[model samples]
Target: MLKAMSGKMCSSSSILQAQKLVDQLQIEACMERFKISLTAADLVRYCQGHRRSDPLITGISSSSNPFKDKKTCVLL
Candidate 1:
């Protein structure tokens, strides 16, 4: 249900799209949490810099040739 709402707002799993939604919600939540209104750009910049606290989010790092001549373990 929530996923549908989120996807309708923008592309699925897009950083910019998700950031836009977060910024919109943050304005209301931030005011209640901090007693002030913060702009979307400011919020986006802050969140990008401190991603450790991000909830229910995962980031991927990939490389075509990540390792050379490395024998990785395999599970039977």
Candidate 2:
């Protein structure tokens, strides 16, 4: 294959190198897109997990009632 650049002849090796660079750029772009998709999925999963585990009853612990554990003290 023959290619002209600025009225200059390009060698086959140079064309091959250019093709390699193009392929590498495409691969990088695909990887970046994949990473973004994975991150979005992870965020959704986290949101669902948090929402699912959220208790409907707020602060129902037995320790919340101070009078429940009251002790009578005898003074000398």
Candidate 3:
């Protein structure tokens, strides 16, 4: 995904893969590679980094998943 964006044209699959990332750092890396920027509020609304707490990589789980608790809410 990063390779495609950094090199030349990005395929549809690569875009799909990038959009699923929920890590702030990974998302920022993607944004940097694409040379895109967004405000904090817009970032939350357009990006899933703050909305989801999943692991950055596929098939991985968050190190500390608080959503397991019924009292936990993802909203800011």
List the global CA lDDT of all models.
Answer: 0.63, 0.77, 0.59
Best by lDDT: 2
Scored by TM-score, the top model is: 2
lDDT of 2: 0.77
Question: Where in model 2 is the C-alpha error above 4 Å?
Answer: 33-76
Q: Please give the RMSD to the true structure for each candidate, in Å.
A: 15.7, 15.7, 18.3
Candidate 1 achieves a global lDDT of 0.63
Give the better candidate number (1 or 2) by TM-score.
Answer: 2
- Models sorted by lDDT, best on top: 2, 1, 3
Q: Model 3: what TM-score?
A: 0.21
lDDT, residue 7, candidate 3: 70
lDDT per residue for candidate 1 within 1-76, as digits (tens), equals 1245644643456656778999998897867454235666788889888787554354433443354445778899
| Positional deviation of residue 17's Cα in model 2 after best superposition, in angstroms | 0.3
Residue runs of model 1 more than 4 Å from their true location after superposition = 1-38, 59-76
lDDT of 2 by residue, 1-76 (tens): 7779779999889989989999999998887345878899999898777775554434445666655756678899
Which order, best to worst by TM-score?
2, 1, 3
Task: Specify the poorest-scoring 10-residue window by lDDT in model 1.
Answer: 56-65
